[model samples]
Target: MEMVVLENEPEVLMENISNKDNRDTSAAPGLKLYRCVAVSFGLLCILQIALNISLRPPLNHTNCISNSEDMTTNLTEERDELKRKLDDLKSHQNVLKSERDELKRTLNDFAHRSNNGWLYFSHSFYYISPIKKTWHDSRNDCLQREADLVIINSKEEQEFIQRWVKNLMWIGLSKRDGIWKWVDGTRLTQSLWCAGEPNNHKDSGEECGEIRGCGHDHGWNDEKCSNSNFWICEKKMAL
Candidate 1:
């Protein structure tokens, strides 16, 4: 049917050819040639549109699958990275567990100690401001507790007693003639005095020694031994 129609349009085709011939050599094509070119482009457009309509479903599916694969690949890489970090953290946890176990074992090695008349850190001292019963009373009190007047020898020994013995106590660091001596035969290393310090009221009848430093009996000064004071004794036990 289409071929029969094309054959019947033979005069129209001859008219188109005649219009192309009338176009000048140096000028653009005539209207009839332009119309023919336009009709050919329209047919090409129609064919392309038909092909796209037929293939739309399958082509869309292919694109969707490609995009899904790319996303899955990215997620897989991220998951692998997370797994590696989890493994590293587990190893660190194991190390900490071992260290904690070792510390617990070490703590078990020591035993607890008990306190008795053996004289723990608890003790007190008394001092005589007036010429009370002579220096004799001070010496006797020190002996009764298995301790002597506080003698500050080394910093270590001084620190040990000073921690708790806050009250004024008779210290062995007394001036003999004019020289300071500790009952333990050790000399005082560091000495502290009060604001108007160590006036040595001994000449005013103050004898023996009294504690005059800032912290307490731990820091001592020369006073008359005739002054009475209580003494401290220190003894330790092993665990």
Candidate 2:
């Protein structure tokens, strides 16, 4: 009986060892599966973080786009305003050109006419008479042509007349009631007289004035109102 009991105890011990080995093997497989699932979840978390960083724009980049749009709008407005100003300038230039052409045409017509031999100079027109007459008659002739005797108002005008007068010529100056005055009712402020002139020779007999010939300084000389001489007529050009 002792021998039989010993044999049974040894079998039971071997069976228990085998069952423990099986339990350990099953637990090892389950632990391996749980580790694989944890690794996959960690990898997914890293990938999601990388995607978020790549997709979002930086703060400065967004501001740069907005500034560029504003600058483009401002430049377009400035360009349009400059174009308008350029168009206005061109229109004014055209008007000035037209006025210049009209003035040139009027001057050309005056140069060719025969009535009293009109001559253009210094923005004024002059008529040189071929026929000689007394001072009063010369003035009356100018009035008939809707003009007046040439009044020498500046040194330039005096020099211009000196070139045209081949002989003594009547002018618009006269001494009235012992006072020198122009035919246009203006007092004389400048004098273009010869030496010792305006003496009213013989006490007021020489009242009218005349541009002397080339022999005497080419200056003015007091003469009798009835003295015969050539004359010059002045009138503004008809615009």
- lDDT of candidate 2 at residue 192, scale 0 to 100: 88
What would you estimate as the lDDT of candidate 2? 0.85
Would you list the clashing residue pairs of candidate 2?
none
**Tens digit of lDDT per residue, candidate 1, span 96-127?**
99989876654442221122223233232222
Model 2 Cα shift for residue 60 (angstroms): 58
In candidate 2, what are the lDDT values of residues 1-239, reduced to their tens digit? 35444668878999999999999998998999999999999999999999999888767977899999999999999999999999999999999999999889877667554344777678678888898899899999999877899988899988888878867899998888778888998888899888888777887599998988535558888999988899999876775
Backbone steric clashes in candidate 2, count: 0
Scored by CA lDDT, what does every candidate get?
0.58, 0.85
Error of 1 at 65 (Å): 99
lDDT of residue 159 for candidate 1: 63
Candidate 2, TM-score vs. the true structure?
Answer: 0.52
